[model samples]
Target chain A: MPPLVLHHLSVNYQDLRALRNINLTIHPGQLVGIFGPNGAGKSTLIKAMLGLIPRVTGRVTWGEADLSAHLERIAYLPQRSQIDWHFPATAWDVVMMGRVKPTGWLRPFAASSRRLAQAALERVGMAELAHRPIGALSGGQQQRVFLARALAQEAEIFCFDEPLVGVDQATTGIIFKVFRDLAAAGKMVLVINHDLGESITNFDQLILLNQELIAAGPRQWVLSPEHMRRAYGGEVGFWGHVA
Target chain B: MLPEMGPIHWLLDPLQYDFMLRSLAVAVMVGIICAVVGSYLMVQRLALLGDAISHSVLPGLALAFWLGGNIFLGAFIAGVLSTVLIAWIHRQSSIKEDAAMGIVFSAFFALGITLITVIQKENKIDLNHFLFGNILGVTVADVRDTAIIAALVLGVVVLIYKELLFYSFDPMGARASGLPVGLLNSGLMVLIALTVVASMKVVGVILVLSLLITPGATAYLLVPRLHQVMILGCGIGVFASLSGLYLSYYFNLPSGAAIVLVVSALFSLAFLFSPSQGVISRYRRRP
Candidate 1:
């Protein structure tokens, strides 16, 4: 059975249909990259998968079990711009929040949770800055911090929206490596991305979406000239090497 | 001319009275609660919400006072109802929260003032005191009510600290995480109402805005976490309360006004000296 299945998912916002009759299945250990233009329902798909939007009409299942049964097994990292980074929380505290529901209220964070937060930060090479306020970090560093926070969740299914935006080349490489490692560990990783060319090489499967699924399959099979034209409203062009 | 034989001699002797002790207790309780909750609101950029809620209680205060019932009960109902109205209007309509807040607070406060003027027909009901409280008139019931309300508010805040932080930092993320963001938002408003009424006697309606915002803003300069900031803010608030009361007695001045002044002074001092986020830290002296 596939790890995640979205069947006939339709989402509406007022008069506009953000997504219509979208159907897809992501198998276990697959690194799926969704490429689309603006207003092409990339982030909307992630939100629907997480049950964020109430107006969604669809059936989502995970590992042959109901999607709602595995709330703790899925981790989602929203776009970096959706947060108020000026909040007076340290990077460690923000990461520690991932352990809160499991630790229960009134109990102080366990030593294991602290170690895990530190380890997650170290994974993103941000362990040394744990004590720093989140507001003090640069945009790329802030993204890394949030990624560490999401990593601390230790979920089997990971979804990241535009994790590569506004980030340096080194951080991008680190993030891709982490995604590859997670996928190799028999976990599913889905990325809503816009870099069409690099996505073709980095992702094991490509899901081209434009308010609907334009194409889906192995990257080499689905990223042909005809599929690119449909997804991009024209030929998908790559001018310069990805930074 | 001896400072030890201070001008507050007469007022200090009043501490021997039970009413005076109750008044002081009520003031301190209100101070701690406001500082604890206010720290989060200030850091989360909701300082104006506190002010809006406080003024929004005016109509309720007038209604309760007119009915010859407990003023807090009225303000509690009025504050919560008005806050919900503002939140709903903001979400369901084109009006922004600021516009909703402006309209709601102004309408409530205006209605309160009008009621007071028309009903009392004079300042005999101590409208000024309610606007700017007089700590000297606190009763035993007032002290008990303040203690209970403060405890309840604090308990709720601590219990939901993680959820509140999550929502404040990123509402979309928190919603996606399946937190009840709407319920938490309403709970915050209710907590604010309880806090405003509890503080009615100490800082009065007029200067209570200072007590709500100052200690938290001061603590924000020194602390990096919400919990620590709240603790520090509470400490600053209590200290300001104690010092303000004592200084007011010694100087023969208003206790509530004195407390706000001291708290503001402390914020000014923090703004000057804090290392990382202080105003002075942002600028360097030319060598």
Candidate 2:
């Protein structure tokens, strides 16, 4: 588990600058949260690190290796809206997609891959619905299915974008528990969160950004009054205290 | 003084005519490839892209005809060009993809129709033959061409099935998993163009979208997986093509039009009665 490092990262969506030169290092065994207000580059920060979008500047590396070259060792969950739920695949089929790269091309999935996929579904409490159409599932169930898919990848780095959006309480609890378990097992877990809600307490570390990094460290260290004001104005400190 | 044959004889009698054999060969090949490739389009919500490429191929056909070159190659190039142009326009501007497709395809289609109409006035070639198709008049050369394209399309689909399935279901995830998304996307565009070009001789550009989309959609209503949708769609496409070909033979109707009609009729049946997702099934489950 190499430390994920981003040095001088910047992103531009056409003429609008979405993120400025941002530097950070995420060590193994840490569950980190990227927090920001709307249009504050929280999502852009993750996408830039993963090289998903066109970068205006900088590179990302995992220890000595380039991140792009090591993408297969990472598991990523995009925002829910990025998926087409109406596609004809079932939960079992989708979880099996995680094994595609590992199984390689021009060959069928191994029996072990099937066992892993089924175990992933069982973990997410979606085992019974493995054969149901994805479109028929509730929003929370859909999110759980995707999480199971990422888990089945068995990667050292787990990246999620807005995983908690529109999900029920049970799914959120299960997701956080799994994230903690992965972190305890020495995996690099990075999450993009949109709110200063009750769930903020679950993150072990925090990277506060508003177009740039205002502060990043342990949760208590990054949530100071001064840092909060710099990132999201003074009013946010009140919301933070409430949470 | 009438001649009569058994039902089996009537069905088998068509195989005795060389022209009928050629038409049936083209129909089956077109059906197989269309259903297979069209399943991708249906899942990606790009069914209209099939229509767009089909229409855009007309100019290529007219130009190739004028140049006394291969119409299939010309139409294929034109179809791919249309998709590229659509992607370029959509990416480089504020225009959405749907609007971009509409703008580019209509322009190419108009150019093609104008060129073909003008060429028709001077040559013995009939414009209606290209617009409505002359499946019964397909040469052995056309059958061979269709077979080659069908084999190529089905081969590529089989070779890249799992990767394509992952990409189609969640492209961002596939890319994040280190798949060559750009290459897969380009290959899909090429496959789509080939399917459209091969189909033009059987259903014509104006009606080819139905063959490319209807059967897949019909199967989608009854299935729970992408590959199943494609296989079932192929089966439905073959059945409809056979029945429609026979109906046309008995009633003196246009073979291509009759085939499309049969395909749509099957789709309507699936829409109404598929057990898992159909309107009738849902209504019954509600009570």
Candidate 3:
């Protein structure tokens, strides 16, 4: 697969510059993490790249085409908080949503789609609770269900925003294992992560940001004290001790 | 006279009148379509948008009558325009959506009331009929128009069920996964406009929000899935319409008010007694 590339991406919220002049190249078979202090445009970067939100200036290309033109190749898991847990859908119902674009318009889900959704639920250990309402699931279980949805999309690129927040260790393990499996299969996996704990070790590369690209390289290089201090300001001391 | 009639005759007596038959047919169709479309409004927490659109359609109705055009078409255009205006105001300015809706809908409503009041001085129209609905005055053409709108709304909804489900549940995920979020949103607005316009004669603009929200909310309390909510809501809406018409016939109550009252009662029952989410059930489950 051709690398996913961003050229001078920037985003503004009215007068406030949320992200500025971000450039990165993400290769296939890499599990990448984006780290930043709160309000550092971590989520904004992912959203801008995917064209979910407007970008002030940038070009995002996957292979030879604009990324916006080939969005079907992407599987995106938004922050869990962004979803309405009270929506009246079962775990199985949400997983089947992944097949909607692939199934094309005006056609019901075929038997093959149903099998894929079922397999995805089973992969997340949620098959037994397939019929349960999503609102009734625990936080970790809800996150797992969304993960199952992304897996069912069968896309070449995966983007997850804060999938680890408010989730259990078991859920975290399952998530990392799935991310690794996707990477091993030669798919690009990018995750926006809040924690810099031991979980940070799971990423093959890190992109640290504070309204701009502070550093982007292998995990250890991007986590260096100087780069951490630059991106996080005075909070670096807390992160340094943790690191 | 009451002692001589059987239960079946009492039920069948209303069917003898052609006007009653037309009203019943239109009411049933309105019930089904409103519940289906209203499920989306309730789930997305855009119940106020429904109220906004319904109220805003009045100006179109007045203008269409003044121009001798089809009032349903006019109302649909006005409803859609109000939503677009609300979105535009919200996006172009820092005004939040709820405030924008409030401003635009009330402005349009005021314009409608003004136009109707001025037009009624010369014409034989009654503003109260439009406000409260005159379902008994529905003509054959009105029934036919409502049927077509109902079919179109239900057909599009059925075809795009999964896409709508995904979009409504997680808009960012759906948009990122290649769905045309804007087109889907516009299509929903159009469907809602059609549903509101089709329902106007049965419930009036003032009370159509009740038909659009109450039945679906009642079913939402009882069911755990969107399709289930819609299906059950349809049943609830139709039952309320049928029973309310009967009560209106027997007690000489206004048809629209009677239907709204019945649907509200059903929602109250669900609120108090639904098995999973009801007040009583949750209270009973407590230790």
The candidate that wins on TM-score is 3
Best by DockQ: 3
Can you write out model 2's per-residue Cα lDDT over B189-269, one digit (the tens) per residue? 999999989888767888888888999999999998999999999999888777777777777677778889999999999
Candidate 1 docks at the CAPRI level of medium
Q: Write one digit per residue (lDDT tens) for candidate 3, span A1-243.
A: 999999999999788999999999989899999999999999999999999989999999988999999899899999877888999999999999899999999898999999988998888899999999999999999999998998888999999999999999999998899899999999999999989888999999999999999999899889899999998887777766544
Per-residue lDDT over B1-287 for candidate 3, one digit per residue giving the tens place of the 0 to 100 score = 24378899889998998988888998999999999999999999999999999999999999999999999999999999999999999999999999999999999999999999999988978887677766577899999999999999999999999999999988999999999999999999999999999888877889889999999999999999999999999999999988877777777777889999999999999999999989998999999
Q: Which of 2 and 3 is ahead in TM-score?
A: 3
Candidate 3: true contacts recovered, fraction = 0.91
Report residue B258 deviation for candidate 3 (angstroms).
Answer: 0.5
Give each model a TM-score: 0.91, 0.95, 0.98
CAPRI grade, predicted model 2: high
Residue B229 alpha-carbon offset, candidate 3, angstroms: 0.6
| lDDT, candidate 1, A71-136, per-residue tens | 666677888877777788999878876665556556667888888888999999999998999999
**Most lDDT-accurate candidate:** 3
TM-score of 1: 0.91
- DockQ of candidate 2 relative to the true structure: 0.84
Candidate closer to the true structure by DockQ (higher is better), 2 or 3: 3
lDDT preference between candidates 2 and 3, better one: 3
